[model samples]
Target: MGPLIPQEIISLDWNLVIAFVVGIGFGFVLEASGFSSSRKLAGIFYGYDTVVLKVFFTAAITAMLGLLYLSLFGWIDLNLVYVNPTYLWSAIIGGIIMGLGFIIGGFCPGTSVCAAAIGKIDAMVFIIGIIIGIFIFGEGFPIWKEFHEAGNLGSLKIQDIIGISGGLFTFLIIIFAMILFKTGEWAESQFTREEY
Candidate 1:
């Protein structure tokens, strides 16, 4: 009954409009929460600030719980949700590259875009680099197509891989998030700094 777009309850044009509105809202929230500051975003790694971790974990857990409730109430069909197919090697390589980029640039692609929107020169440069990287990746895709497709794991859910029910997996994730949040609080206290 829900998943309005896929179910045709909402028209395609309306879906696009909704998506744009949501994106703007999300960006506003991110900027308002200081995600526009590379220093603030990087603080997660330095242990000086744990706001990033807290916000990320809170959002993730909230979404998971919301989806669970939605499914339970028959407002959405979990089975209708799309999951990306796993390309093991490419995923690992991409993740490593992304991690390095995060450490060095102090901003992920999303935050960089948000910062760029607000006139951050560094973020603008980062975005240019991202566009170039995308171009290179697209150009080289054909050359590495085999390796990219090597790990042909079809769309698989974490619960399936871990041999647990979705509900149980979500519960465990929530618990893990809570533990990490507590740890983050401790880290922030220990690493508190006079500036940033």
Candidate 2:
């Protein structure tokens, strides 16, 4: 009825197996969708290709709405769902670092893995960097542990905080997406090159 593991409908082994299956599906989709190319991804910023924007925003808003609907239907209790706990300063600083990494490295952990699977040398290097970064984080967790634990707005709901119904909020999101989609289409026509 809810998240299977939390509801005890699925055992941990079943949960892990499902996660692996989902990951495989996700990776296959991304690779097939051309997300495996860093150039293809960075095009979101430049506007030559809107595949990244289209896919990302579509996935995000769809999931957002789906969760809202699930909560409304009493299928998934919103209160029981895990929200990413906030670490305010860490979020800001980490976001900046992550943005820089995205700009320079051109692949995030997911996309890098996707590209790596499809045999891209750059993506393979990016995955190696991610592994090294993970190792460093494990080694240095004590140093930033305090900051990471700082701003715990535990499982906060944006809808509750903003005092707006999720339906209305989703409407606003759809409007914004329509505008962005139009602009992206315009830019793609304007900026597309023969080379790419």
- Considering every candidate listed, which one attains the maximal lDDT? 1
TM-score against native, each model: 0.95, 0.90
* lDDT of candidate 2 over 61-173, digit per residue (tens): 99989988888888987666667876677889889888777768888789998888878899988888888988998899999899888887776667678999878988888
Regions of candidate 2 where Cα sits further than 4 Å from its true position: none
True lDDT of residue 159, candidate 1: 91
Error of 1 at 137 (Å): 0.7
What TM value does model 2 have? 0.90
**Taking the tens digit of each residue's C-alpha lDDT, what string does model 1 give over 1-196?**
8777778888878977897999999999999999999999888888988899999889988988998899999999887777799988989988999989998998999999999999999999999999999999899999989988988798988899889987899999999999998998899899898886
